[model samples]
Target: MSPFWITAFLDFSADGFDDGLRFWSALTTYDVSPRRGKVGEFATLVPRDGDAFLRVQRLRDGEDRIHLDLHVSDPRSAADRAVGLGATEVADFADDGYVVMRSPGGFELCFVDHPAGVRPAPTAWPGGHSSLADQVCIDIPASSYDSERAFWRDLTGWEQRESSVSPEFSSLVRPEGQPVRLLLQRLGEQSGTVRAHLDWATTDRPAETDRHVAVGATVQEVREHWTVLTDPLGRRYCITDRDPETGVPPKPPTD
Candidate 1:
């Protein structure tokens, strides 16, 4: 009875005006959120289990687009809708026919779908998504089995895995090597600032950020790419769409 975790991406809108607008529109239908005094901000539809969808746009020297992919119930239909909304087609692979696309603002995303069984849902947070197609799981670091299991159960509302993964590792809702999990084990102490962190892809950016702070995540300084954030347990992560190098996605496996 551990709480579920959902994860998604945020387009760091460091591109130009038109480009930034394009990405925002494609995700949330062109409704860009106006900043207090800054240029603008906007977000996409949040996926189930994920906490937020972040948006980043550099004022000058906009960086590269972070490539990312998400699973959905329907691939063909999702591709059509994304194209209709202005998602640029980059390319497609065989497995899920990952429709490589770039948003209006140069941030990269894939309206991915494949001929596979129904994908499992993600861990739901306070400001998480409400969509069925966009849901996926997230793995977190837990110190002990009892504490880890208790925290997730009280927070995410996800179930536990029946099979044993390892003495230290325990599966949350999803299976081993699946989209979501919780790594409950002991680790060393911290050193300096984290090299990477979770960039929150949220519905209401500032509002969701506030909620994150309330949940025990310490708000770190915002970098040129995106905001630097730490989870309740002090784990670092980023919430961005365009990763200067590989974004936040894992490198594809080779045969």
Candidate 2:
């Protein structure tokens, strides 16, 4: 099987598209790519100096959410592999060169035949804060956590590792040069469905949190080394105290 290049996407309702675009662009220091799709519903958030990894879509109907797109040389074969690994074909757009499938945890992913590229290096912001919106954290109910983690690991062929910070947190580690990383988070309690949100690994969490707030994101809650924030369009994301370059959390200070 061919390796897949992952891209994260923010799906917003038509009503929230403008705010989502403005807020995300400001947060990531990205510019909107020329709109595509018949009604101009799809656009990418192009980074200032790196390959683009984020995209936005204005859904004709449905609640706002985050999803992933797998770019491969052959969409049909990739989609077939996904199905073999417990994914269900939600929609087929092979004529258009893409297919939408639902993973076992119920997360939607699109497989496309677009050319793959290396993951762009993360960018630094003003005020000594450096980070990138390079991860999509999938929130899975405790009941489905193990299966979800396995499904993603099989689908992407990415190395799987558990986070030292929390047992419930695991990651489908991206290979070197892949832009987007998938973090599978097991919710403490059972939920009706699996969901996902964006996350940024930042050298300075406080500074990044403040910058996001200044640009229309609201601080929802603060944890030991991470802050949860709600964007202008009410979507949630996190700024964590992790190395932007390596995407690894800093080691705790010695006693």
Candidate 3:
């Protein structure tokens, strides 16, 4: 069965944990929940309007990366299905209600048995602008792209569609009411495991970009509709010109 809720977890090193938390909290205008877990390694960004779908993880080891947590009805069963579809089980924390795994392309994620139904609305700011961190784009190398895409397609049972914006991109259609959507980007020929980055849909891209820059994000590049920036912890994300409420890019002008 497909997950009912999806959360984007931003993993950060021990030394950079607070900085990452502060940066993301400011960006999303969400309150940071008290640290949880045995070693206080996990925290959630609590939205004011609905269930939160963004979290921060303080890593004990490994480089910082973005990962997903699929909230399902049963963690063990979901993990089993994922394994059958080519995911590698990394750890079985069934007692804790989740199982960690890596996809065929080496992107780490977890199947979690957590109930969260209401999706959050966009965060409003001064000057009548709004934004929401709504998508996670998985960067896949060409060598692993096809199989990787198939694995996620089978796992999520979501419609797969090529992106109208670019040939190099395709997306796993988000079910109605899901908090986060998955996007797969086919990268040029390279040798490496897949990685993930977050995306923000904004009503006013220029204003949202400026707000993010005010909070220490450095501009990396500006595309036609999206502006790339590196967070204080140096993770890459984008401010996209998509409707904050619907997460869709605006239609082009007709003559």
Evaluated against the true structure, the overall lDDT of model 3 is 0.92
How far residue 98's Cα lies from its native spot in candidate 2, in Å, is 0.9
Model 3 weakest lDDT span, ten residues long: 240-249
Tell me the lDDT of model 1 at 114.
29
Off by over 4 Å in 3: none
Model 1, range 56-163, lDDT digits (tens) per residue? Answer: 334344332333454555445555555655455677653545566554333354555422232234333355531111312222233233443454343334465542
**Which prediction has the highest TM-score against the true structure?**
3
Model 2: worst 10 consecutive residues (lDDT sum): 118-127
Measured against the true structure, the TM-scores of the candidates, in listed sequence, are 0.27, 0.96, 0.98
lDDT of 3 by residue, 85-162 (tens): 999999999898999999999999999988899999998898799999999999999889999999999999999999
Give lDDT: candidate 2, residue 15: 96
Cα lDDT computed for each candidate against the true fold:
0.39, 0.85, 0.92
Backbone clashes in model 3: 0
Clashes of 2: 0
Question: How do the candidates rank by lDDT, highest first?
Answer: 3, 2, 1
Backbone clashes per model, in order?
A: 41, 0, 0
lDDT, candidate 2, 70-95, per-residue tens: 88888888999998999999999988
